[model samples]
Target: MRFERCRMLFGDEDFEKIQSSKILILGIGGVGSYALDCLYRSGVTDITILDFDIYDESNRNRQIGSDAVGESKVDTLAYLYPGIKTINQRMDMAWVADFDFDPYDIVIDAADTTKVKIEVAKKCYKKLIMALGSAKRYDASKIEVASIWKTHGDALARKIRNELKKAKFDRNFLVVFSPEEDKCKEKGSCVAVTGAVGLTVCSEAIKRILK
Candidate 1:
């Protein structure tokens, strides 16, 4: 009954597809945490969440898990959302090789670290989605979902493209990025921009699985 409305929108068969699809998400910060929220409420029953960081007082402004400061992100999420088959681990690129890609329908990279983002981009086997440059911007309308090759203006996007090119990665991949340049270095990011990036990433994952 919890998902009855979802069943109405997707039909029973496609709703089953949504429930059965597996998604792996890296990072539990401003962007990834919001993405997790969207996917879980949208009827994704199988999810693998990985994050090496703990909630911080500073994260309260954007992250959903910000209240559980000093707790492991995975543990907090597992306790908060029960009954879903969630495989959560404190992981980073150092242990990325151990990840089994075969089971996942999609992999999302919302890590704030540029190195980690590039690593995920380079090694991901499943349909990959990454978010970039949601920081220092107040405008959520500038956020765009496009192929990584066509994405421009975001500083992180440019860096990722440079790294991918050197590695000879030619595959067209989806990226949630903003072309708007944030000029003020002292200006901080907010939930509005980062949450939009997260929701966009989740939407892309759902579309990929359904289509």
Candidate 2:
């Protein structure tokens, strides 16, 4: 009954695919959390979340379920969404080089670090939907989903593009980005924008799975 509406919308075969697809989400911040929420609520049960950071008082403003300060983000998420897997480790170049991504049907990159995003783009380009710079913005309506090369106005996306080019990443991958100008210099976040970005990323993943 939980996914009755989703089942109605997607039909039985596609709904089954959505439920069975293996999804990997990198980062458990504002964007990733909402993406995971959208996926799970849509009947996508098999999800693996990866994050190295612990919840902080500052996270309460934007992050979902940020009640436990100093607690592992992955652990808290796993607790909140039982049956989903959790990896509570930082994604670095070394780990990225060694890890195998063949098992996952889609990889969502909501990570804050450019290095990790580039590495993920290289390794998971065929099945990646990355989030580009959700912070320091306010307008949720400005969010757009496009290939990384076509993205503009996001400094983080620019940096990732440069790194990916230098790394000889020739494949194109979809990304959720906002073209709105930053409100200030400081890295601040609003759930309105980040949540919209996250939901957009999830929507892209759903489209891919249905295809």
Candidate 3:
């Protein structure tokens, strides 16, 4: 079955295949939450979210729900998207390493910790991963990944990617959530910026899949 909303873009074959491909999202913050909505509309029916954070009042700044106060954020996501599968636990490589899971076709990283990003990359090196996948996609337009991307889709990323290719550094999606000048931790932000990043993440995901 097709979600009418995405009918304008995803047609028969792409939608069908995408619906079957399992997606594992690693964060549930503002960016991840927004990206989830995009994923749902895009017809990715099987989604697994892993986050260990509980709702807080401060999250009202950009998180999915303020009413979810004290509730497990992942739990809230599962409820909003009924068919979604969720694992509410802090992601550690050990959790993934010891588990028996079908090799996920894609991994979306939106977790808050840099450690989580590195760990997830190590844990799921075999599949095609997406930028900093999912939530991390938000804020990436200006968020630099170690001077690689001065702005979103900058040339340095291309340079590094080419070097990695030459060195055969296992091909994987390395998306960065760029921090905008105004939203810099040096600055501050609202949901608008967070949403921008989430949509961008989904946009990149679609583009990659189309390519």
Best by lDDT: 2
- 1 against 2, candidate with superior lDDT: 2
Cα-based TM-score, every candidate? 0.92, 0.97, 0.74
Between prediction 1 and prediction 2, the one with superior TM-score is 2
lDDT of 3 at 138: 34
Q: List the residue pairs that clash in candidate 2.
A: none
Please provide, for model 3 over 154-178, each residue's C-alpha lDDT reduced to its tens digit, 9 standing for 90 to 100.
3333544555556555545446544
Per-candidate alpha-carbon RMSD to the true structure: 1.8, 0.9, 5.2
Task: State each model's CA lDDT, in order.
Answer: 0.82, 0.91, 0.63
lDDT, residue 107, candidate 3: 73
Top candidate when judged by TM-score against the true structure? 2
Please tell me which model should have the higher lDDT, number 2 or number 3.
Answer: 2
